[model samples]
Target: MKRKFLLLTTFCMMVLAACAPGGGSDSEESNAVSGDGGSGKQVLDFWYIDPGEKEKVYQEAVERFEEKHPDVEVKMLRVANDAYKQKLAVSMSGGNAPDIFNSWGGGWLKQFVDQGQVLDVTESIEKERFNELALDNTTFHDKIYGLPLGLSLDLVFYNKEIFEEYGLTPPETYTEWVEIIETLKENNIIPIALANQTKWPGAYYLMNFAARIGGPDLFNEAFLREGRGFDDPAYVEAGEYIQEMVEMDAFNPGFNGVPYDEGQGRQLLYSGQAAMMDITMSLVNNVRTEAPEFEEKMDFFVFPTVEGGQGSNKAVGASTGPVWSVAADTENPDLATELIQELTSQETAEAYTNRTGSLTAVSGVEPEDEFVNRMYQVAEEATHLQMPYDQTLPPELAELHKDTTQALFGLSITPEEAAEQMEAKAKEVLE
Candidate 1:
């Protein structure tokens, strides 16, 4: 499967490159100019990754801003997800960054903040309007550097049709979840759709599981302590659980090699080959687009309660989606702030949520997509929204988390070994 995905990706890249007029030598810098004719309106540049069909929602907000402010012109750049971070980094280093750009909550933005490249939005915006978890994510060193536009919770998305076919409902506890997997196996169906080859997706699942077993507070304590090891009993327990599932053949064949695109893990659920998948709320949109016929059969639920675990039954993993931040050196700071306000306002939030089936960071804006709305409802009910470990921990430690988790699946090491490694890496980073 890895070979197949690689070939497909390579082929697509070649075709796209051939079709384009130029190679990938475009400068990352934005040519934005602020200040309207002499004393006119200000112009701002905003950069973000394409959010499926929600581009127009953002454009409309910019239009509204222009109408109200008349003197301001907003330029929007839709960058690819893989290119956004690197491009923004380059632009920042060159001192030609966009007025506003998207950024992750953790290390990605941390590096910029450390370099004094991002503006602190906490002072300009009212953080109360956003979810507490979302706000917490952007807050670093007692200052918030960005405004969250959306959020994503890591949860289990199951195929209603598949579940019903196998006489299963969303499991309410980890024990039940294990039973459901066994039942699915009995019926010759894969219990989970996992695309471990993409690496990040698998990491999310591991983080979610570990958080549940260790409990958010304890997990965070371990993550923040230097010389703390990943080989903690709780961490090992989570890894062993995942490894057990892998050994049971709960995932689709070759799942470890499937990339995110090409419908990899999702394909299993859509095709009725798998019963469940652990993924972000965005999967609802993907399912709607790629398998509309199965749309009605799709549903989601929080990860089941871990038996005898320290985590609360309602504990769930989540993170603020990429946020919009302004370059500290922007020629027009006020214009950039205004653009952010417009972009994350109630109207734009609603439109983006409705168009992309995403949960908005803005309060009081309900998601229009039923599945997404349901996810938000469940997430809100959770006692705690534990940020995914990868996003909450330092980058170096996060990578170790992923590597050890993957190693567990490959049976190269026991869960104890993996946890020990995680602890060692966490300690090094935290100290």
Candidate 2:
């Protein structure tokens, strides 16, 4: 009886020993604790930029993802917009990047790819059915490294009442646009609400102008370090357009001093101090929330065609919004990839659009707002969607592009000098 008891006690001790840390069963060491036993589940640190209501929208998606993937855990971290870029750069360089994180694609995300820090998602899942234009931003070379979440279009938002007062319709050609600007100036009205202090506001005009003058090829040539670069005549012509608008006194008085985020810029549009404003799709809700009455008064138009240019006015001045890229160093590639797809899936895309009013990249999902739907129409019809240089270029180059554009608007630099300055900055980046 003593011998039998000793044998049983020895067996129990061996079992307990095998389950503890290094001595535990190899399976136990590999698995995460869930209940009484262990779960061979992985946790993915998911990071995202919070676009206002996306916090709540994404929380719901997380809940759903957790329910469907009980074995995989998704840990979400949200960062503010301005801080997100710096935060992402630091984390990636530090080798502690989240398993899956947000990116603006183009040059910003390209840095990660060059470092071999992002997973090549070419064959992980099906992406063929998505809008190819939307996919263009996240795709590097022929392989896709990330999934685009939505479309962010740039449009000219005008108060319908104000346009009627001026006896103007949304201009369909560049000539008509200039005429309208002149008419507004003659009427002693601010032609457009602009806040050049921020620089990005000026980028909208430059982006559209460059696209109109040179088409996607010019920007692409500059971006890819191909023939001609930003020194192309197209850029010079685009700079001239910027100067022309400045000469027409198009933007609000003292616009160079008004700040973008302090409500001063948007207030100009809301209070009818300005007739039109170049804005992003997301600003629809801002108008609805802050100036509800003017929300009904708001209408939008795409950038008009230039009379003598190789450009397609049909192409929208837009972005693929933000994309989610999986880290190449993640131990949880399968879960990370799945989480990214799930976040950008058709259902989630529709949900995001409905909740936030942003036009998603998902083809079939539609926003109920007619104004938003019109924005989507422009996106769908775009022969090419051009990324703004400020967002598409490297940080230093982007800042310089913005600065030169602001200089053009402030009349501190001639169009020729503006183009030259931008081209000089471009060579430093493109090479």
Candidate 3:
């Protein structure tokens, strides 16, 4: 949800180039691939942030790509999660960037796009080939800059067993949701499990609350420099609602101490330490593999709608965060474009869904994983698929939003005060 660069220093680039782990062509030391047709072949450098077996899937795809285009060779680089962004920043703005790289097309990508680091491949791609929701972040100013690889949705994943024990069903409205939370508390059960150690998880609540209160347009309008801004009544009301939930002790005890990614939050849900969790759809695989019994007990529901709010009940919180973008400085734009096209094609989407048990952005590929398939259905029914506010806003303001949202959850700042802080920050950065 957070990313950017102050400046891509030459020293930083050098460091990244030296330290980055190389894949594909074992002979290539750096990404400055030669495009000379003297050998009747072109070489392209690609960087990706695939943490596990995804790299293996991509490797197979690269092999298939090589077989298809015998004259083009791809120099793939696999970077670890922690270092990928900074390395990518340096490689893009300071030095010769890879011909293509993995990106999340949002305000983070906007910075690179503004610096002319990424290419506009509008004509190269078919806009209708992708889900419009996934494509939301891929375009800027009516031009496409990237291709969506996968889709992720955030919903409340609850332990159905726990719910049944408490005679609970998924709530359809905000008031019902609050009553359920209160019921869970009275029964000495934690209603929602929260983990704010990384901050984005907490920000999800704020984003969804705002979306339900103001509908999809309000946040977009505010971020696009409209009159509403961060001081909009809806955002403040979201914060106020969050504060009220916190005051009611709806979240797990010591939730602020739990980290989201390091197995803490997921552990809480699967172990029955908590009844429900707001989680990204990608966790289905992990839940499937690690806790099959728990998986059977798990089911998700979209965040409930506000009773008299502007947003529709169908507006679910989802994002197409990871995208593959071609670098602007690539010598072989045709080859780079073709490669990304193939990677995001219908066949590849099906292959990726099969291999990873996740959903891809390509419209036709129905994921084999049942949970992911259901999530795909959820995305299809959405009136508006909203990206996390922290990802949609400009870099600095996004960070501010995350921090203030976390603070709101922690009860350190009142909702009005949080809105005031965000308005001041947004004015400084945008105005």
Listed in order, each prediction's TM-score against the native is 0.85, 0.83, 0.84
List the candidate 3 regions with Cα displacement exceeding 4 Å. Answer: 1-43, 50-56, 69-83, 186-188
1-431 in candidate 3: lDDT tens per residue? 12335344656887787766544233332444345544757888889876454566677778889999998888889886446777998766655688989977888888888888889999988899998868878899899999998888888999899889989999988899998999888888788988787788888888888988988788878877875778889999999889888999989877777876577778888888788888777667667566767878989899888867888768877777459999887888998998998788777778777766677888888877787678778877777888877666778898899889888988988899999999899878887
Q: What is the C-alpha lDDT profile of model 1 across 44-73, one tens digit per residue? A: 778987555666777898899888887677
Q: Which candidate leads the pack in lDDT?
A: 3
Model 1 C-alpha lDDT versus the unseen true structure: 0.77
- Assess each prediction's global lDDT (C-alpha) against the native: 0.77, 0.79, 0.81
Give the candidate order by descending TM-score: 1, 3, 2
Candidate 3 residue pairs that clash: none
Give the backbone clash total of model 2. 1
Worst ten in a row by lDDT for model 1 = 25-34
Please count the clashing residue pairs in each candidate, in the order shown.
Answer: 12, 1, 0
Off by over 4 Å in 1: 1-43, 69-72, 94-96, 226-229, 368-370
lDDT of model 1 at residue 259?
74
True lDDT of residue 264, candidate 2: 90
